[model samples]
Target: MAEDQLMTYAVGEQMNLMALLKNVTVRVAKNGKQYLDLTFEDRSGEITGKFWDASEADVERYQAGRVVRLTGKRETYQGSPQVKIVSLRLANADEPHEPGDFMIHAPMKTAEMEEELNQVIFEITNQVWNRIVRSLIAKHRDEFFSFPAAKRNHHAFEGGLAYHTLSILKLAHSVTSQYPNLNAPLLYAGAILHDLGKVTELSGPVSTQYTAQGNLIGHISLVDGEIVAACQELKLDVNSEDVVLLRHMVLAHHGLLEYGSPVRPRLLEAEVLHQLDELDASIMMMTNALDKTTPGNFGERLFAMDGRSFYRPSEGLTGKVDPEK
Candidate 1:
């Protein structure tokens, strides 16, 4: 299908197109019959669908990470767009499209991201922090750049983990410049390494899911463990103030105990890291919703943002206020 044609079907319109099987789960209905809960994706976006009365063979054939041709109707279920699957079949061997063709990716190019990351690392003048960050990043380099920051929500795409990190670093740079008292190196290092745990937290890019460790131990604690292990391997004292502070950055990034942070942000840099992380993620979520919303309308309610919907003002409205004469 042409790029323009992707996801352009009007509600109730029937569509037959190739899409990547982003996710597939066997679900049991009240009637005691099994069905496939499916998520289909193309470059445009994703939609959920239901394939009812599925057989064992159907489950095996419609696995995630494969491209399939599906016939379905565009629909609204509880205010969200989904598909009512009429039929679905695996793509033929001769089909031109592949799973990679439908995978979403970070906006920045990999080379550009790498170069920018290296520049940020160079700014981590603290010797211990520099070595630790360099070592962990080098060790998990591929996964760090390939895994999604999450299974869903903000920055959930190929290389999203790294992209989100870089975004926070950019924000931290400006914040540190204006506040001068904030330690630039500490904030930068925290930003780079804060979500590094997500590489371990989430499975690879294709059909992303949370791993057992992610569900149980969680990313913050997992990364803190990694920092401790790295210290052991690198022969650095884990008890040192530098190591403790670095660990605290990751542990307190979620901002509160209820939100998964084991501790609150006691350090100024840790507080800044937490705030910047929230700021970047909030911006991404709101921007994504606004992109799909028509001008002068409110977008969908964002669950991550207290179930609030944002408005996209019509073009040509001056956002600036006139100064008093």
Candidate 2:
């Protein structure tokens, strides 16, 4: 089979691209016309698409998560690229494009990140806590490496769960080193297991969406339940202080009840976990926005960040070595 052509549609270009159907929504316009609004993405990037006068059959056939062949005319909407769909169909089985071609992925290698996480866990001296953390991680290592941290929010890419966890672990380590009073084992345990339930919460890495369990239970409580189960399986006392504090960190890492944390952070390590998680997520969101911005311009409004826009300065500054000299 021949390789599918890359999706590189210019404005007004007629595109016949085979790509993954991302988020799909069917809505009625003001004129009472039903249409399909969708996102199409390959490894290159994503673009919005609309199929006007769409029928119910179309909605059922080209639902989100399916790979499809789209015929559309590229156009601009609100300064962003979009497609006016002419026709589309579910990709045939013989479709040459690999699934990996349609998904976004983390910058770092999964094995490298996993090794880093293993190192962090191996450093924990508290045997009970170390066993608990290591057990949970080992049980879900495959999904942990493949699942995104979220469906649409930050770290929503292949290998994102591990990437996000490892990034937080590094931040937590640096923080604990500076504040000698902070508990390194507790922080490391919290960092590794805080988002463990995300493995079950999300559908998969590509064209990610929340699972039924995710929608009903959520990652925080889901992971808390896992910790409790691990305690039982290991014949450890759930009521022990170490177990309680570790569970507390997972439950309270969101930092507030309104944000899905059942309890506000009460322990110092729990508080630090919440802060580090927030800090890492915020930086990822900001950096993602910055990447999209033209140098010297404000970024698109970030709904997740309270509709704030980030700035990317174009001004030249000194580096250790100047390239333009």
Candidate 3:
């Protein structure tokens, strides 16, 4: 019920770790190990803890996602924090709680992001592209307005899908505007439609879990199919070859097939969309990781940002005067 206090085990502190640890991960041990690997987390961030005591009762209580209380000494494993657990118990039910009590979230404004997204859709001038975009928007506007761009990796937050999609379109529209050689409509249409299926492919308000269709059909096939259907229903003369071009943007959006794209990006528009998506996503993720940093110090090592950690400059956190005052 109480706010679980963070254990500030710095680089050299004697981690009196036998304190309550919450938000831990339970991983199945590889190749028949005796114990499970538990990853515990709090707003200060996460640590890996191994629980070897394996009592049947304890196993039931500490299943993956079930919050647990723990006592352990904090230790460093290759610079990241590790916990040596001495005692463990499940968090009691009927406690005052919030989902944020466990899951981490991106530093972003969902409402503001969605509002800017509408502006991008509004900017589409092509009648055909506008028709398709508007139809997709109408079907999943609520979810698209709230869905995550991914379950993890990049842009994985509430309203993240809209934010990431809008950002990609913004960059694509801005960059291609400089290159008169590029087909503005092709690039813009591709960018706007590239990730629309993601609105339907992911679920969860606190966690961006994949939908059943995400695993079975995948976003590429889903979006491509939808584009074809929309083109047919609208009686648009979307020539088969050009539809292939639009589909290529969806299929090759990841830049390569190994990353789940069915084809590699070959066209200039496809290549640009792929790169811009990566650019926008990677920059936003790094920015999100950087924001959690404490003043005048390095941040908790971010696995999502590679092995390297971030350092927050002291003045970055300086107090500002309230203009209204």
The TM-score measured for candidate 3 stands at 0.72
Highest-scoring model, lDDT:
1
- Evaluate model 2: give its TM-score: 0.88
Which ranges of candidate 2 are over 4 A from the true structure?
1-16, 71-81, 84-87, 92-95, 315-325
- At residue 203, give the lDDT of candidate 3: 63
> How accurate locally is residue 281 in candidate 1, as Cα lDDT from 0 to 100?
93
Model 3 lDDT per residue over 1-325, tens place: 2234334664344443222233234445554545656766555545677888465565666654455566656675654457777777665566423445654444556677666656776666667776777787777777776676886557665566777777887787778779879877777778877888886676653435578998888888888888888888888776756666777878898888777888899999889989998899878766655554445767556675566677777875548888999
Q: Please give, for residues 247-304, the per-residue lDDT of candidate 2 as tens digits.
A: 9989999998989999999999999999989888888888766765556878666787
TM-score of each: 0.92, 0.88, 0.72
Number of the candidate with higher lDDT, 2 or 3: 2
Worst 10 residues of 2 by lDDT: 1-10
Candidate 3: regions farther than 4 A off: 1-34, 38-48, 53-60, 63-75, 81-88, 100-102, 203-208, 232-242, 284-325
Best-to-worst ranking by TM-score: 1, 2, 3
Q: Superpose all Cα atoms of candidate 3 onto the true structure and report the RMSD in Å to 1 decimal.
A: 6.5
Deviation of model 2 at 7, angstroms: 9.1
Give the candidate order by descending lDDT: 1, 2, 3
How many clashing residue pairs appear in each of the predictions shown? 0, 0, 4
Residue 88, model 1: lDDT of 91
